[model samples]
Target: MKKNIESIFKAHLEPKEVYKGGKNIPPSDKKIYKLSSNENPLGASPKAVAAMKAALEHIDIYPDQTDMRLREALVKDFDGKLSAEQFLCGNSGSEIIDIILRAFINEGDEVIYSNPCFLPYSVFSRWYGAKTIDIPLLSPNYDLDVEGILNAITEHTKIIFLTSPNNPTGTYIPKSLLDDFLERVPKNILIVFDEVYRHFADAEDYVTALPYVLAGHNVLGLNSFSKTYGLAGQRIGYAYTTPTIANYIRLIQKPFLLPLTSIEAAIGALNDSEFIEKTVQTVLDGRKYLAQAFDNIGIKYWPSQANFFIIDPPLPEMEFTDRMMEEGIMVRPVSQFGAPGKVRITIGNQEANEACVKALLKIKS
Candidate 1:
């Protein structure tokens, strides 16, 4: 008989709810507005839709092994400081996280990240048998604590994860603070910046770390087309880093990493600059409108730099979710992000935002 290998299996395989992409409740005939997931409320770029329709005719043919066109487009987007050789595409930002972890993390190594951050940081770290050093975000604003993170570092620390316009909280680390923090980190330790919501951030101090990558730092910027391009269903994301690191990640990636349709859709989305600009403007305007509505309704919410923000409702979270569903809206209860008594609300189209505000006022009253 074959010997049992269950004893050697990795521990703590309990699933963690990572991304809040709207719950899969029964398909009711009623129209349901999804304000749960941070998807683009404008729907996908029309160009992407058209490209996908064209790509349907070529599904039988295998995709190109190297995503040359997509990589070149991404490099051009960066304005020539970055080369096509210094990037890799993934099925999603989550897969990019896994690729980096697999490439660098070893047994008993330590990885540092903030609490209530992208949950995949902890899940994937534990999966690889690496110790997770989760530092709490500074109180009130949920800002990234550079001092706390620095204090948590040890000789065994292999990676540090930071997310700007962080999930659930919709907070970000200021560029000045980040510049100082980057200088203090050990040269050997890898710094991974997940800027999945970069396009939505309009705060004065918010900035991208691509310059650091250009200056030859051990930092990688992981981003997704899901939010900016409304292609969450397409599951396409990319990472920008040094060519050496990019080559290492590429070595461990799947043979046919991204589907042909997703590739075409991303290319199309990139071409539609007008659509992307309109989507960003809509989110910005809607954010201001919702903030005003929340103020008038007496609901407490975080000042957001991303397309979502955390709200503390008077009613219990599940009750709030149920009530919103009755009002034809779906919002995510985010006790999962360690913020009990609060929920994450994705900024949606003007109509959806107005509907959510109206529902909240009713619940509160």
Candidate 2:
């Protein structure tokens, strides 16, 4: 007897497509530049690399279940306002997203987020049988519509997920706007701030929600080492909140949450401020260069505070992506994020950025 898998998933049958990027192209004589995933072009820090190499020797032993040492190193970076007990390290920031939903969301609960924001918010909300309330972004800029979001809230609303320098759009919530929002929002509801791109943001008015967490609000700050430390492969990140909430998340998390290598690598990354500075500086410089190139070519693109930007090309977005790949450049077609006719490109190294601009200009001509 054949069992219907769709029937098993029931309403969840419509699978959410998780966009995978940074795939290695086949070896060729021509140079290939990967500008698809918003990875640090500077690559993993030397300290992280050294830490991983040292960890390999101790693979025979089990890692610390609580990730104590790594958490201790991270505590100092937060300037001692956040204690180590308030932090929980996971495989990735995305994993923490899933963990948060599992630990908090009940069936039929409501989770609100903006459309064209992080895809995972909707995807995982639905996966947990929670109703996903998607508010559309404000037009012309694709920024969050705080009023609309506040209007969508009800008694069933359990969580609110917000991303700064939102994925695919590169737009951020303003400080004053967020301050107003936090005050207006219900104090009982949990608010999650996904600041995975915080290190790359240089906008003068762009602010982080960590202050809320420190001020005894029901807020959680989620971050990853993948983008800033170039530790994507290492698969380690952290979530910061009140010790009360932290204890609950920790209780539900699977034991042996992160491997020894990931823990050590993360510790090494937190200790290497010089490398982080260099990576951020390179992306900042490359972002400016790409913006200028796009302007000179008359291509419409978002001026981003993140390591990536979305641009509307002359051709269809996917067609533009194909042409880019054919020219030995890889970028993300962001129609999946509800923005059709636009492609998102990561800010690569100077050489890669120049090559990508040349390819894009060639395709336009």
Candidate 3:
């Protein structure tokens, strides 16, 4: 008889809850308004669907193991000017995050991330036996403190993941501050810029960390088809960086992680310029409308440049989130994100946005 198998997972396994956006319902119900996950309220790009459909018959063939089509589509903005070697495609922006961590982190190595930022980065850092350095955001806006970040770096520090228009808070790093940080950071430390919400940014000079990649610095920019292209179901995401670094990550990732149809769909989404434009407009309009609603209702919200904003409710964040869920309107509670009294509300479609406001007003009353 075999003895009980020992748990292989290391000691630092601080389990994170797998989030389900809303209550699962039978197909009989017509609609459920979900504003929990920061997903595109407008669904997948129509052209992406057409492209995926076109590739349906070719299921027998495996996807390009190297993810050529997806990479090519991402760099199309450069007139094919950017080399294809500088990209790595994988199962979601989340997987790419995993790949980078797997490639760079090791025992005793250090991984740094902003607090109340995307949860996965911190979660995986612990998973890989690296020490997780959680940095708290400074006042008014939860901004990345350049000086504090620089001070945290040590010889053991291998990576820093910064989320622009950071999750939950939605406050972005200023151009001048980012530029200053880049200049001061050591060349050895690779910076991972999670630009998943970059497309939602409204500021003109809102500096994204992409230029760090283009400038041949130790930086890589992560993007996903989930939010902007509305392909979360397809699970395609990518990293853009200098050829050498990108190739390193690509080499570390498992082959064929991205499905052929997903790559094809991404290509289609990119080509359909109008759908992408419409998605952008929808998010912008919805966010503006929600901001006005929040203002009129006297609910304080942090300045957001993304598809979601941080609601600083007078009641506890967990209470607010639970109350909204009871109303059949799901929103995210950042109380678990190490922040109390704050909830992240995604900017949804017209109906969803209106319903959420109505729920909030009712709860307030």
Superposed Cα deviation of residue 295, candidate 3 (Å)? 0.8
Name the Cα RMSD for model 2: 1.9
C-alpha root-mean-square deviation, each candidate: 1.7, 1.9, 2.4
Q: lDDT per residue, candidate 1, 1-365, as tens digits?
A: 67678766666544655544457545889877898889998999999999999999999999877787899988778878899989889988988898899999888999998877777888788888898898988888888888999998999999999999899899888989999999999999999999999998988889886988988899999999999899999999899998888888888888777889999999999989999999999999999999999999898999988998898877899998889999888989877776777888999999889888888888889
Question: Model 2, range 1-365, lDDT digits (tens) per residue?
Answer: 89886667657536667745446666888888989888889999999899999999999998887777877887898888889999988898888999999998888899998867778888888888899998988889987889999999999999999889888899898899889899999988999998999988988889886888888889999999999999998888898999898988888878778999998889888889999999999999999999999999988998898999998888888788888989999898877776877888999999999999999889888
Stronger candidate by lDDT (1 vs 3): 1
Q: State the C-alpha lDDT per candidate.
A: 0.88, 0.88, 0.83
Candidate 3, which ten residues in sequence have the lowest lDDT sum? Answer: 19-28
What is residue 188's positional error in candidate 2, in angstroms?
Answer: 1.6
Q: In candidate 3, which residue ranges exceed 4 Å CA deviation?
A: 1-4, 7-31
> Quick one: ranking by TM-score, best first?
1, 2, 3
- Local error of candidate 3 at residue 345 (angstroms): 0.7
lDDT of 3 by residue, 1-365 (tens): 66554555566665655433333332434355678888878898999999999999999998787677677777795467567888888888888888898899887899888787777777778778888898788876787877788899999999998888788788888788888888999999999988889888988768766677778899888888899888988988887888889877777777777788998998998888888888889999998999999998999998888899898875787788778877767787776675677888889989999998898899888
TM-score list, all predictions: 0.96, 0.95, 0.93
Q: Candidate 2: which pairs clash?
A: none
Output the lDDT of residue 293, model 1.
91
